[model samples]
Target: MISFHFEPSSLSSTEKRDRLLKLSVVSSPILGAYFFSTGDLSSPFACPLREFTGIPCPGCGLTRSLMAIAQGHLSQSLSYHILGVFLFLFLVLALLYFSAELITGHPLKISLSGPLQRHKRLLFPLLGLFLLSYHLARLALLWQSDQLLPAILNSPLGQYF
Candidate 1:
């Protein structure tokens, strides 16, 4: 059996890569659940933020998109969430890359923190701006179309609002 526990500081670059890959795999079931299920779990799985505030967060449709992608419905995934395809592909690639490193015993860890640290100021703000813009646009469109609030209000948790 492959041991999933490893001390990070004691890990070789290859081991660390393997650890990262395993961590990604751990989330696969959840992503699969989202991909396979039609989200009838809303009663139990609803986002508390959305349930109470009637606001859709940036990650709202992520799982459903993954489900669509799992079924080979790329366009539908994108329709559910614009960046879902990218996120899903990224997770899959990361898992595959790390798993390969673990099996090959190669230290192919890509050190990105250095450059990201160097450009933190610019990158952080840009990321924030992009997220804020996307969220606002999503909210604006939903709000203007008079859909978000009503839908939230009609859900089982509507009494809370």
Candidate 2:
């Protein structure tokens, strides 16, 4: 069995980011295998939040969204998870960044950090709120259309409905 320890305080931010990018490179194929084997927007991987609360958290359809994006179904992917296209792009960017870093002998200057540093505290929470709102809106649409019934019916309060 494999075990892992993540002690970020021990490493410089650049080193930590580089390590994560490297890990992303290694995990792409594994993610691809999962996406292919799962075979649709409904992943076999269950969300604990959804199971317990009868409502999805912000990331419910991410895997399916990424898979759809991989299959060139951009619109469908966005319908599954609004931010998944951006997520896929970030994954691609990380893969390229790590690959380039490996081929070159120097560390690259990180992008996004400069801008993020200015409003790090404010930006992250706002982004989280935006994503949660988007997810709730999507769920509302699904619920109105009766598409989320099966999931709802399986939760603890399913007895009342």
**Which digits, one per residue and each the tens of the lDDT, describe model 2 over residues 37-140?**
45555665788888876778889888788778767788998887888887877777677665555455345555344556666679778988999789889889
lDDT tens digits, residues 1-161, model 1?
Answer: 11233223344776675577685785674466565566442222466678666778887877777777766778887877777787777777776656655655553444445666577679768877887888888888998999987977876577555
**Model 2 misplaced stretches (Cα beyond 4 Å):** 1-21, 29-41, 111-122, 146-153, 157-161
List RMSD in Å for every model shown: 7.1, 8.2
The true-versus-predicted C-alpha distance at residue 157 of model 2, in Å, is 5.2
Candidate 2 CA-lDDT value: 0.70
Q: Which 10-residue window in model 1 sums to the lowest lDDT? A: 1-10
Q: What is the clash tally of candidate 1?
A: 1
For residue 52, give model 1's deviation from the true position in Å: 1.8
lDDT, candidates in the order shown = 0.68, 0.70
